[model samples]
Target: MKRYPIRAAKYAVYLIILFFILFALLRAFGSASPMSVLWTTSRGLMFLGVVVVFALLYPFFGFTRKRLTFNAAERADDVERIMAMCGFKRIGSENRPADDMLFEAASTAKKVAMMWEDQVRITTDADGVSFIEGNRKEVVRAAFRMGTYIA
Candidate 1:
């Protein structure tokens, strides 16, 4: 939950900028009066606030953790491919700290959409138990892919 505030603040900044642009466009091209545009923009911002709050909060409270176990016969390459197919890119070697493979959303647009909290860390122990950690929705999606692909 500690990360929520930072995410919210960042999103708020973006939303404010978006609303300002909308206001300007409506006033200039839509022939809307300044006060009307201001009112509409304010309402739009409020609606966005509600939506963004729910989006950011749901992962913390509403999602279940997902995990996968890969036997010795399973290759990490296959796992990487599934992750890539699911829109993840492996973190570069220089930053990887352990046997753990770190991944983030493959595209800048996705990173921004996820508010940059789209990391999915997979660390397999000697027993082949791989723990998945990060934003819940992405983890669940990746786990589902890995499960189906590796099965």
Candidate 2:
């Protein structure tokens, strides 16, 4: 959650900007004192700005569309094992065995158009393996932690 601090800082700055802008607009056209106008509009305008920002960003960051690859340093089987240890379930193995390597990030009961989560396709063979896309650092950390939890 190191990113949380950065995001929070950005939000704080935005709120301050919004407060000043609203205060200025209200003072320019209204009869109220600057301090009185701020007292009246500050909280409501700040909340509105924050809501707009959140609504715009929630879908973008909460459900990201990224195609990230694994580095050459990682091995093929190890990658597969790590994926399995994490929550990703294979797409298919019965009709298309090789195609089973394609996986969506979430293993929830409802499967949609794969829009709800990230996806990863692993290409492994006698040749060295590489990933088409995945959340790399978090995936690696989770997989490594799995090693300690196995009975």
Candidate with top TM-score is 1
Pairs in steric clash, model 2: none
CA lDDT, every model vs. true structure = 0.72, 0.49
Q: List, in order, the clash count of every candidate structure.
A: 0, 0
lDDT of 1 at 98: 48
Judged by lDDT, which candidate is best? 1
Model 1 C-alpha lDDT per residue in residues 51-133, reported as the tens digit of each score:
57765765566334555766412466887888899899888746654458888899999998877877777877777767777
Model 1 C-alpha lDDT versus the unseen true structure: 0.72
Candidate 2 Cα outliers beyond 4 Å, as residue runs: 1-41, 54-77, 93-100, 105-115, 123-129, 132-151
Q: Give each prediction's root-mean-square deviation over alpha carbons.
A: 4.3, 11.5
Please provide the root mean square deviation of candidate 2 (C-alpha atoms, Å). Answer: 11.5
My TM-score estimates for the predictions, one after another, are: 0.63, 0.36
